[model samples]
Target: MNSKHQILVIGAGTGGLMMASRLKKEHKDFDIAIIDPAKTHYYQPAWTLVGAGTYDFEDTAKPMADLIPKGVKWYQDKVTAMDPDSNSVSTEKSGEIKYDYLVVSPGLTYDMSLVPGLSEAIDKGNVCSNYTDPKHTLEVLKNFKGGTALFTQPTTPIKCGGAPQKIMYLAEAYFKKHGLKDKTNVVFATNGTVIFAVPEIKETLMKIVDRKNINLKFYHALKRIDAEKQIAWYELAPEAYEHNPAKLEIEKEGNMVGIHYDMLHLAPPSVAPEFVRKSKLANAEGWLDVDHHSLQHNKYPNVFGLGDVAALPTAKTGAAIRKQVPVVLDNIEKLMKNQAADNKKYNGYSSCPLVTEYGKMVLAEFDYDNKFTPDPELKKMLIFDSSKEHWRLWILKKYGLPYLYWNKMLKGQDV
Candidate 1:
């Protein structure tokens, strides 16, 4: 049935679910609906701990039916396309649905095929990724008998930029626990030059890298995975660049390097869902064309977005969704009241709980310019250190944050 509503959220993800929950609670009269085909919602942040054997895999998931707001209708359908000019979206199972206001938060998709042989090898051999399957990663980590272990971060933006290394740190700690540290040669390969974007946090992560005695290979982006050979191929990021509109001019030859590994964990390239990229509502870079501040669509005022699918120049993480939820709701409320949404602005706040070890983490929080913006209450409770590894922060990550996410954030309660 082709239906119309006051608000239609395209995905029942963190951003979409949180937005619906808040709106339904705040403005009870608004007819809001969320569409997603998935039957389970995952607490992805906990997957890192799950991969490390600290958290349970079963604990990382909840039935989507349990998490959807009580009043908002759920459309168990996949979105196929959007007609933003007419405020309607097409779905694979449910056909076309129109809305007065739309929230586009379908999130992102992983391109494991971006690297040759990765798709065939992942979650099958000693090769695994916490991103794709935490259970397999747990298996990989548990079976390690010491040797060359390499953790890789792709050239494209990933869900949590720190995830590639978070598992590396945990695996290192695991090696120590299993008496395999001395024999294991741990390596972290990334396309970026620094461990982190924020200088303060980068400095601390650098120290952790040094203390762990892990090899850091900068400008290395995964290009191929020869699982049969137990070798990984990478291309060195080119130094010179030509401002080609379509493709980059690079010297592709002589830049490839191959490394053998006993075990490997990789963060594959991620991009906005294919539907969002192909839609007219997307920005030049194939993300939702929303204002980075207001979380509102620049061209279509009735459309708003927040999450990995949105074109915000910040790290994509669930923590960012916590801050972004309120901003988007406030602006939507403003729109409801016929008031300008100019004052309601999001400063691109995002966070990465850098788990340095089994019991220590550096809670890195920052705003638009990558400035560390600590929460006053958390700072006071955590002794105001967001860049240093602390047990309290680890506790927050392991136990506290997940509780807050399920009990508060999903219920529209501010953390």
Candidate 2:
């Protein structure tokens, strides 16, 4: 059967769901349809706490049918093809859906198979990843008694940059609480030279690393894992000039190294899904090609995208999506009216509450320019430093944010 909508959302994830709810509320007559493969909706930001054993995995997920806005059509199927030129998307189960405007937020694809032996190691024993399914987090944490615990962040861009290190800090605190801090050697091995991209936040993080005695390794990319030997292999980044496309530069930096570990937490490489990557609307790097400020497709006027899958040069987080939803909704609405889209710009605002320990967090808020944009009331209302880990902020991340996401953000009610 032929289906058409004023706005077609390709995914029912945070970005798509938020935009659809907003559009439906703003204009009831505007037809909006959301397509997602799964019937469940997840609060992904809470996964970090789940990995730390602070939250139950079940609490972080919800029934999609309950959260999706009433009146908007929901198609429970995966997007098989995106035909932006014809303003239509084909789903695996449902047939073609035509649209006047399209909002693509399918999210990134986690490539767990990229790292050799990683799949086996993660499936075999005390290994976990907070980025994927949260159900297994508790089981993995329960087995961690002692020994060298390794946490890794890949070179590829991930949804939440701070999540890998956030779990590491939680693991450190968990060990202390369990009276096993002395027995466990916690290490953070990442491809980045610094702990975080923001200088202010990085300063605080470095101090935490020093105080906690957490081993930090830079320029180290996880190459493989050995579950039996409990050895995690890493390859150093090649020197700047050594990156000659003509030659194989695998060992230009040095020989691959290994770190023995009893438990491992990994953040895998992520990319746009193959369907979006092969579509005409996507960039060469396989992400939805949209203008950084406008959130509109560079080539296709009818297409727009946001969230982790969009080619926006900012931190890919739900916090960024909060700021982006309004921009995407407004621009698409303007296009639907046969008017030129307004020039409402996005400042690349994104936030990451760097939970260094159980009670402490370095609130890292910045934009595309890497300039800090702190909340004005945070500076005025609070006597204590907002950057420091406070019980108030912890409650905000743990309890307050989830409520805001479901009841407010998903309902088109903005704070």
Each candidate: what lDDT?
Answer: 0.86, 0.81
> TM-score of model 1 relative to the true fold?
0.95
Measured by C-alpha RMSD in angstroms, how accurate is candidate 2? Answer: 4.7
Model 1 poorest ten-residue lDDT run: 241-250
Name the top TM-score candidate.
Answer: 1
| Cα lDDT tens digits for candidate 2, 306-334 | 89999988899999999999988788767
> Which pairs in model 2 have colliding backbones?
361-389
Candidate 1 per-residue C-alpha lDDT over 222-293 given as tens digits, one digit per residue, 9 for 90 to 100: 788889988888777775221111111123348787778889999877889988999988988888898888
Model 1 CA lDDT for position 4 = 96
Q: Model 1 lDDT vs. the true structure?
A: 0.86
